[model samples]
Target chain A: MTQPIEKIETPKGERFIIPIGPQHPALKEPGHFEFTVDGETVKDATVRLGYVHRGIEKATESRNYIQNLYLLERICGICSHTHAMTYSLGVEKLAGVEAPPRAQAIRVIVAELERIHSHMLWLGVAAHEAGFDTLFMYSWRDRETVMDLLELLSGNRVNYSANVLGGVKFDITPEQAGDVLKGLDFLEGRNRHYLDVVSNDALLLGRIRGVGVMTQADAERLGAIGPTARASGVALDVRIDAPYIAYKDFQPALITETAGDLEARFKVRVREIEESIRLIRLLLEHLPEGELVARMPRRIPAGEAISRVEAPRGEAFYFIKSNGTDTPARVKVRTPTIFNMATVLSLAKGLQLADMPMILVGIDPCFSCNDRMVTVREAERAETWTWNELREHGIKVYQR
Target chain B: MSNLVDQITAGLKTWARVNSPWVIHFNSGSCNGCDIEILATLTPRYDLERFGVKLQGSPRHADVLVCTGPVTRQARERLIRIYEQMPEPKFVVAVGSCAVSGGVFEGCYNVMGGIDRVIPVHAFIPGCPPRPEAIIDGVVKLLSSLQSPAPVQPIMGPDGGKA
Candidate 1:
């Protein structure tokens, strides 16, 4: 399905070079891409990232397994649990310790909750980008209900620090369980309203439909994943494909869309949120009775294993190479944003400059958690402009 | 239709400016330590809005700029642009260990070390993305600082109107 990079000549002799992001209001992360355009069509695009690289991979080498859990959580605030979950699974495999059944269930619950929060957040951002301000406000306000539930379960709201090496650090009581159920019920109803807004809203559909079209073949060739790949009819989700944690016990329902556009991605995420709600209900009902933590090994064995978790974003893969120590010898993370960023540039081409914000925010690039920039030359001559200068320049040109 | 009405209007404006601070966040390139904490403040636990702080999407509509990460070479210009877009009388709050001193990324290439190199930082909230409570505390402290009136300009001597 890989399409060769083709070049098309246009009537206009001058080539169009559109540089998007690195500091765009539409993008939450910092990554830049330059698209070569001919007339209104995108001819080619080159992506440039590493703007928010903090050298976390190198920093991980210095921290122990316990410390690395916090470091991994810092990877992405929304998918903090998945990072810790995958890291713990990888290290546990090396240490030869299976988490207790109760702990496993708790992990599943937390992971699903994280997925719910992430998708709702994405929905709000996407809505905001498409100029649907009311949807943005409602979605973000609804997301707080899930955050409150998570806070009730674990002490912290964002970084729950629930996942440990052998088991979860916290447990839920009967009262807390009731609160969670009530929250979920409220979310379920609110989600239905969201579905109506996303599906039928004329403005949203107009902006997203038929925009940023990526073929199934293009997605596979680029290794696009999560909703991005699924939206392109690639039925690939790590939770179902490679079962990990309690996902093996309760498989997640994979949602796919054949039409690969912004609307398709939106549909996939919305459907997944519903699936997560159902999964959470089923998990809470089938709560197994057992101890939370098993005995964890003091030292890990000298071996390497790869663990992948379907984070809210996509397949969050963690490669842990242990050397029979409390700290790992090598730990590498392949976040989903790294792969999806490529598709953002591709989809951005041929689209009007005004539509760029919606397309950029659709991928939800977590540049801060992933890449670190490396300056090649200290004395390189590059033109720099301030925000005021750019705004003034833009105003002058647009006013005319 | 008098001086009383004008005084009341000015008082309301001052009160709104002090109570409701709209913050625009910019990530120059540090580890996401501070950004998470900033978001945490918005959650129900901290409920930063109850204190009248709100997160804004664009710099033009912002009253305060909460910046995280050590400014890297790639992000330096962008950071400056975002800062300049904001209106005057704006305050800058640098959050996290990285934003304060670049923390571990201080000596690394691409990193400019601290956010102050690019923008005028009004306050520093330290801690690898200081705790949520700490972020709230920092914002509150920044508000208190803004409450103080500007220092009177030094009177110039009659000789050439120079100090």
Candidate 2:
């Protein structure tokens, strides 16, 4: 059943309350928005999140630095390496250890590979939201090549646990190096096709051209980063601005667009896939030869540091505070989604309900990664229910 | 006529099992722990379709529900509603450490802890995200259980399946 768009007048003026999420189909995560509209135009928007809060920061305090790498990678699967890399850098700083040049180079390669995978995934999602199912299928199919490369490099597909305290856990052998080159070659070919589809597709252009426009000043003020910020003409990229991992060795191309529309966001991601391809090629050619790991002290001194890496999403921040123990005192991860989600309320105001999902997916907010769960009520009734209770009553009833 | 009817029923159930798996992804309020992993399965790497397991946009079309996150108070009612929307012979696969037993979100205020508190989970896929392969394995296991003639196991309330 569709509810008619209703408007209510306040002391200020007539304002329509448009609910965008919490249960909306547009968002992959669970977050709600109430937009005050005036005749198909958005006057103001209010965002309500914390729907999926899971208390990861609190969970991090109990775990040690080494264990935290695995936990941190869970921040966002699309940009898993950025979390691991940033966390490692923070801990390395506390330990006063520098990763070997070779390790740094490999980190850059994997990180770039992650960017390619993530951006490709976003392209597919954006395409799907735009009702371009073929593009979605094609882009996702090609994304497998990147994932295969990641699997080849680090044994696993998603959370590669490749990054360690002083350096990376895995090393690239001569055979692996050849495999990397071959993977890059295959991706170079597939990317051209992807670019062709994204750049020339008429239907996709019409859907995203002027949708969810964000001005440069507003994007900066709202703390937008990554493709969302770049789409608004922000030239800031952690890889180029700060230069972590092997990014310092080989500079990555910072792709930006001034349009600040959904189309521009699409262009930025597509261009980034190209730049990532370039960065990987450069790293492969100039890869330094040395040990992948560096010797380090067991206990990190009592010090605090913040490290930021340019994830495919945007600036992934990791703040680590140590207290002279293996277990960290505090570890706070401020993901790119947190900043990107802020722009959703603003963008949703002027858009139709149908356009909401496309715009939401455009930011690619990893709601699951950002939200933490909190208990609000106490359990008044307790029954030591067995599996049988579930099988007979709960299972059968819910099943039908 | 009876034999023909049996054949048609078998074919329809098989078609339904492969084509639709009605998924109810529960957040239970996690640190986005298993959420990304679940997303990963839908992405290119694991491409969940080879098994005919498609992520249902809503609970109504879902025959298999996948719940992530710990069971938080805010998500309880919404989770129950989504589960109730699916037709009969549904399977709930709880993914992640949080969904299984609240993982790290156990002591948090907003969370009711494990998902078993609110819904009947047919299978548990453990891990921060339970790796894509593990997710596929869990779904396959659930599918096989659904195909079997044994009675479905309950997750909560008295007279339910034993923990």
Candidate 3:
């Protein structure tokens, strides 16, 4: 297969290509990235996704609204609720039915819990990539408390299909609320300790400090989202910018960092984890009381609605167009990882070949999440590129 | 004398393989649920490493392939390439409902059914994304079958033969 969008030519030294995906040990999901290296320095990098694409967007067009709800939940398991919630929120907007206040609060609670599970997962994965296995083990161990809480609230763990068409399927009982509060207390201590550890640990600091740097201007220009942008001081969070569902009632505190390095990204995520714990507690304390669901027709009203939610990785934006039929006209999902890919690719250049893994994992490159909508068929051919031609092409594109 | 020696070496190899199974996980096309659960099994909480099940990076160094997700069109060839790269006496455990029967992803344009369609599966751990405990149970079940008296049949196709 042709390596996509990579060219490196340094006449002084020999350059070789290193393909680090599809089945590489370092990556968890299936996405191909080729780094052109001169000695130990990476001169260029290119990414090819769609290895995890299952025609989800196309599949959504065929299925009805109810079926699409279940299908959409499977888009990215870690942020499954966000996908469902986003889809439901958009569908409800088109149908013009407001979800009950109690249900909206319940959605926010689960969303916050999901954020905690996701960040802890990312922390462990990022740490593991940096050869900090001890921290990885410790973080994952603490992650279970949130996992158990999620499973208790919703029957399932990863893909918590809590959001229904107009409301949520589950509600928090007093007993469950108490358990969640206790869980949050334990998690709060652990997160603080982790915050201290990541900031203080010499080993991690050495690896991540000043690595994969992205400035605020570049972050905005590259269109980075979620914690990745927040780390670079972009200060763009969907929950805060545009409140939806329960977010209006319980607003999230925006967390941002100035460094714009790998360490900055780590800090943003860890701090967000703390923020999520606090949000969950506040939601529990002021738990609303009402019916869990509202009635809506199977066929959604003919209209298009946009839904954007802050997923753990970043913004999960969805555009739903209904044609007054059971099936949707178009269901477009722009996952956070894809929005942050340009930033990752730009960061991959001019770094040590060994440090590439850390940069790639810094944004928690969820290929499954990013490539769920786009499908690219790998052609049977080998394409080559020269350094000067690539630079000239880039310059021309920039000039235009 | 030669036959006896051959049997002894084979027995030793089987015993070694049965004892320590190094795993390499590949997410062909999944929701990240099953993959995380698999990683969780490796951490301190579940600690599948305690059973000598190390999650290796290279396919050549590994004995078992812990496959997750449905076989997508773009990933189909790459999945096959990975399966073919593994050393002999290899086993594949299809973890999650998607790998078993394409689960919810079945009939999607890009989905090509289960992992078994592309690779011979020894055990199918059925769950949307199986819990860490369930994943451990599935791995343990596979190990026990390897030690069973009867031969292990990998691919359960209509032809009913071992791969």
Which digits, one per residue and each the tens of the lDDT, describe model 1 over residues B1-163?
6899998987676678779989988877754546655765775546799988888556778888888877777677767877888997688888887777776566555566777666677788887657778888888877776656761121211232110
Once fitted onto the true fold, the runs of candidate 1 whose alpha carbons sit more than 4 angstroms away are A1-13, A23-30, A366-400, B1-23, B30-63, B70-90, B96-121, B124-137, B149-163
Clashing pairs in 3: none
Candidates 2 and 3, the one with greater TM-score? 3
- Candidate 3 local lDDT, A1-400, one digit each (tens): 1233334233567666655553321122345677776765778877776555678899999999989999999887788899999999999999989999899999999999999998999998788667677898999999999999999999888888898899999889999999999999999999999999889988788888998899999999999988999999998988999988888988989999999999999999999999988888888888888989988866688999998998988888899998998899999998877777788779888887667667877888753222111112133333433222232332333232
**Best prediction by DockQ:** 3
Per-residue lDDT over A187-245 for candidate 2, one digit per residue giving the tens place of the 0 to 100 score: 88888887776667776777778888999998989888889999999998998999876
The top-ranked prediction according to TM-score is 3
Error of 1 at A96 (Å): 1.1
Q: Rank the candidates by lDDT, best first.
A: 3, 1, 2
Off by over 4 Å in 2: A1-15, A23-30, A367-400, B1-21, B30-54, B101-114, B127-134, B151-163
lDDT tens readout by residue for model 3, B85-130: 8999898999999989889989998888888887788889999889
Query: What's the ranking of the predictions by DockQ, best on top?
Result: 3, 2, 1
- Clashing residue pairs, candidate 1? A53-A371, A53-A372, A387-B81, B30-B69
Q: Each candidate: fraction of true contacts kept?
A: 0.16, 0.25, 0.62
- RMSD list, candidates in order: 8.3, 8.4, 7.0
Count backbone overlaps in model 2: 40
Q: Estimate each model's TM-score.
A: 0.80, 0.82, 0.89
